[model samples]
Each structure stands twice: as C-alpha cells, then as structure tokens.
Target: MMLKLRVDNQEIEAREGKTLLQACLDNQIYVPNLCYLEDMESPSASCRMCFVEIEGTPQPVPSCTVQVKNDMVVKTDTPAVRQLQRTALRLLLSVHDVDCKNCHANKKCELQNIAKFLKVGLKPKRLERYLKETLIDETHPFLIHYPNRCVLCGKCVHICRGKHGESVLTFARRGFDTIISTYSATDESSLTCGDCDTCVKACPVGALAVKESS
Candidate 1:
C-alpha cells in the first residue's frame, strides 16, 4: 500500500516498505547520502551523511536506515541535520585524497557532488586533513583499486558479493587506520577481481576503474 508522509513540509506518496531515503529520492528530493545503494542492503552505514530530523526523535537519524511511515514527519534541511552532514563530510574530506583535478572521477565523483550540494568546501575547514600513504592495487588484471579515493561506502564490496557468491573486496583494519582490501595473494593467479565491472558501476566515486591494456 502507498503511504503518505510529510518531508520538509511537502506531502509525498511513498510505498509501504520503502526507506526514507528511497521515498525522498523517489519524490525528486535531494538528500546527501554516500552509503545507500538501491538494490543492496545498507551493509555499513559508515558514511553518516544522511541524517534527517524525524518528529519525536531527540537526535537526528540517518535517513537511509529509517523506513517511511504514514503521517511521518521528516525534516531534511534542519539545522541539526546540516550540522551532522557537514561534520561527517568534513571528516571524509579530511582523509580523502583531495586531488580532484588529476583524479579520474573528477566531475562524476559523489564525494565532490555531495560536497557541492552541501555547500561545503573540499578543503578541511575546522579539521586538519590527514593524508595516508597512497595504496594502489593493480594486481588484478581488469581493475585498479585506490584506497585513497574510497569513502568506505562499501558499494564495491556489496556489488561484488551480490553479483558473485563471494566478496573479493572487503574492509580491513580498524578505527583511524582502517582501509579496504581483498584476499592476500601469493601470486597473480590468486587475485579474484573477476571479469565483471559491477563494482565499478556501483561505485558512487571512481575509486575502482578498468585497467587500460598496455
């Protein structure tokens, strides 16, 4: 059954089981999100950029993880929501490569786009930028994985797991030193990047890409 909900003072028709993010997007509403994929379960709500104010909630909640309900009231552009999003985005940018001009993703990058949407500069404002050692894995024949460009959204990991039975791309390490990785390989034959580009297509940012043949 279709449900009616109020989003930012606009009444929108959303389906019974759709998420708040899905409902908002279906209505052409713009919500800054980096971790929600359409066909996949939110494997990790690590991005923390989709916060919205729901009626009766003391704290802003991530919209991607909330289901839409009849008569539900949601405020997407509230001061609290903006603050949460701004802080989350600044943190993401702080550790990001921030080399947009030479980066392959460039104009098509989600991080860049969301930053623009939020009116936040890519340069670290109140926070200091932390640059980790560049990790480029070209072991796979068809693709290159740049850990620096990744936002840890897990889109690539979910796509790999969804398309195939196993997930080759995965999160490694913990806390401030965390990163994404695949199974370690003793030789080139052990690498499992497969021929499909599902992960690349699913990636909101251009962190993963096709390796040009030499």
Candidate 2:
C-alpha cells in the first residue's frame, strides 16, 4: 500500500510501513543521518540528526523512528528541527577528532557532509572537546579501530552481524570512554573476519580502516 503525505509543502508518496526518513530520502529530500541503514530491522536513532516537525506533534521527532502515515504533514526545515540537528552535530563533534585531512574518510566523511548540511562548524565553540587517550586499537587482525574518530553510530556492528550472522565487533566501556572492541580470535582457523570489509565499508566515519602491512 502507498501512503500520501506532505513534506516541506510538497506532496510525496511512501509505501506503507516505510520510515519517514527512508520515504524522504527516496523522494530526494535530504535529511542528515548516520546511524540509519536500509536493512536495519530496528532503527537505533542514535545519530539524532534526522528530526522533522509533524503537524500535530508538540516537538520535533527523529524521522528514522517514525513510520509514514496517510495525510501526514511534516516540516523538515523548521527552526526547531534545525536547532535539534545542529545541537546533535555539535555534540558529536565535541568527542570527534576533526583532523579530516589525515583521516581516511576525509572529503567523503558523513560527519563533514552533515556539518555542512546543518551549517555547524566541525569544532564545537561552547562544548569542551574530549578524546580517548588510546588513539588506535590494533587487536583485530585485519582492521584498525580509531576510538577518537568514532561517532558510536553502531552501523559497523550492525552490518557485521548482518553479513556474518554474528558480529566480531562489539561496543565496550561506557559513557565517554566507550569504544569498539573485537573478540579475540583463539587461532588463525577461528578468525571469521578474513577478507571481509563489510564493517569497514559500513563505517560512516573513518574509525575503521585496513591496517598497513608490516
């Protein structure tokens, strides 16, 4: 079934049960997001960048978590929506290492694109920047993890699980110290990440990369 809705004053049709974010993106309406993936059965809504104002809602809601409804009305460019997106971007930047020139993602980084879309600078003016002391984790045989550069969006984990039935990547620690950790491979035969770059490709930031050969 197809549902008709008005977004930014333009009529659009979305399949029933499709997320508002997916619907908008399908219609060429850009809503900044990072944590969302099309294959995800349940949206984490972790990025908090895709907020939209529904006509009857008191406040903006994350579009990735809302299903489209017939006759629904949405405004993506309202002051409240922009403010929420900017604030979320700034929060992500506070813990982010903004050395784009040296980063793997660089020009193609989602954080850079989202910052550009939200008109928020990569550096947070009011928020104190915090970074993990451990810059790199070399535990994984085929991959390197950068804690400072990660946005904790969990796309890599989700993709890894989807590809391999179970994920070798898992989040460890809590709060400001959280980082992606890999399960220790008992032996060469026990490793499952062999030649699999799904997690690396799924990372929106340059947090995961192929390690240089020794």
| Candidate 1 clashes between residue pairs 3 or more apart in a chain or in different chains | none
Off by over 4 Å in 1: 185-194
TM-score of 1: 0.93
For all candidates, what are the clash counts?
Answer: 0, 0
Minimum summed lDDT over a 10-residue window in model 1 is located at 185-194
Which tens-of-lDDT digit does each residue in 130-211 have in candidate 2? 9999898887777888999999999998998888888888888899988888858435567787788889999999999987
lDDT of 1 by residue, 1-214 (tens): 9999999899999888788998999999999888788775543567898899999999999888888899999999999899899989999998888888978889999998999999999997788877667668775667788877888888888878777777878888887767767646325466555466788888888788888871
- CA lDDT, every model vs. true structure: 0.83, 0.91
